[model samples]
Target: MTLDPEDEKILTLARSARARNGTAEGAAVRDETGRTYVATDVNLPSLRLTAVQVAVATAVSSGAQGLEAAALVSDAEEPAQEDLAAVEDLGNAILFHAGLDGSLKGRYV
Candidate 1:
């Protein structure tokens, strides 16, 4: 789905972080632990992340491929148990809203 302007800006920060650093920074990446202390660091009213952190987060939220890469980079357990379903729902909503529905097939998003 296409991201809103605010989300787009935030993701831009994330992308920039990845471009600058090879991977997540400061907070640490762990397969079992998920993204520790990341929200705490970036959780501000501004809703922004350090370029370094954004890179890692962007990668994590990149969807299917991201899920695989994140699995390798660190053992982050994924978003919270509750947040997972919500995220999935959001994705579906975006698809439906964009008229892709279940018919995108190969039409290209």
Candidate 2:
């Protein structure tokens, strides 16, 4: 499916992060103000977080009242419930799921 240029930008950011960090997944979120946040899966020995969760946390911590959109680049067929909850907590932001090759797979809103 074709996406808006802004949405495509986040997807590219997510895919780049996953490749650069060698993580299982990567995610990016666009805030209501048009600011974007990117993150890879956090797998510390003491704390584990999905990429989408981290992205959402970063956006929130940065004073984003709500999200406009989010992108998740992963091999998983579906995003984790926790990740979805994170985005939902912010607002009704569209969530785009993409494959490693940057192919659009699914969308949630």
Candidate 3:
């Protein structure tokens, strides 16, 4: 599917985060107020969180009432259930999945 400019921007951020960290995944989310959050997967022994979950947490902590859209750039074909639940918690939002190279793969809403 063709992504809009904002969605493309999020995908770009997610891809860059993944590449910068050399991690398995990266994610970006745009809040209802137009703020964006980007994060890479955290796999520390004491803390393991998917990129999307981290992004959502960041948004929530930053006082975002809801999310407008979210994007995850990863090798996985689909996002984890926990990741989706995070987004769902913020309200209905679109979740875009992209390949590591930043091409659109699939989406969940």
Candidate 4:
């Protein structure tokens, strides 16, 4: 897919988070106001959160009213349903999935 500059930036951030943490997943989201949030999966023994969920939380905590788009870079072929639900809570937005190598795999809107 032909990603615009913003989309590319989000994907790159997500990919970098994953690589830096060496974790299962990383995610990034762009808020409606053009703010970007990035996060890696939280896998504590007492609590677990998907990367997408954490990214959405970051946006919310930063006072973003809504999201424009989201990206997840992971080894999984598709994002988990919980991740999609988190994006759904913010608003209707396309969710892009990228491989660990930073290649676009698919998108959910």
RMSD, each candidate, Å? 14.8, 0.5, 0.6, 0.6
Q: Is candidate 1 or candidate 4 better by lDDT?
A: 4
- Check candidate 3 and list the clashing pairs: none
**Number of the top candidate by lDDT?**
2
Runs with alpha carbons beyond 4 Å of true place in candidate 4: none
lDDT per residue as tens, model 2, 29-103: 999999999999999999999999999999999999999999999999988898889999999999999999999
Please, what are the lDDT tens digits per residue for candidate 1 over residues 1-109?
Answer: 4444533333333333333454432222211223211221244586755322433454356432222111111113223333233223323211111111111111111
Tell me the deviation in Å of residue 39 in model 2: 0.2
Distance from true location, Cα of 50 in model 3, Å = 0.3
Model 1 has an lDDT value of: 0.28
Which digits, one per residue and each the tens of the lDDT, describe model 4 over residues 34-90?
A: 999999999999989999999999999999999999999998978999999999999
- In model 1, which regions exceed 4 Å deviation? 24-109
Candidate 3 has an lDDT of 0.95
Who is ahead in TM-score, 1 or 3? 3
- TM-score computed on alpha carbons, candidate 4: 0.98
Alpha-carbon TM-score of each model against the true structure = 0.26, 0.98, 0.98, 0.98
User: Model 1: clashing residue pairs?
Assistant: 14-54, 18-55, 30-75, 30-76, 31-74, 31-75, 31-76, 32-75, 34-76, 34-77
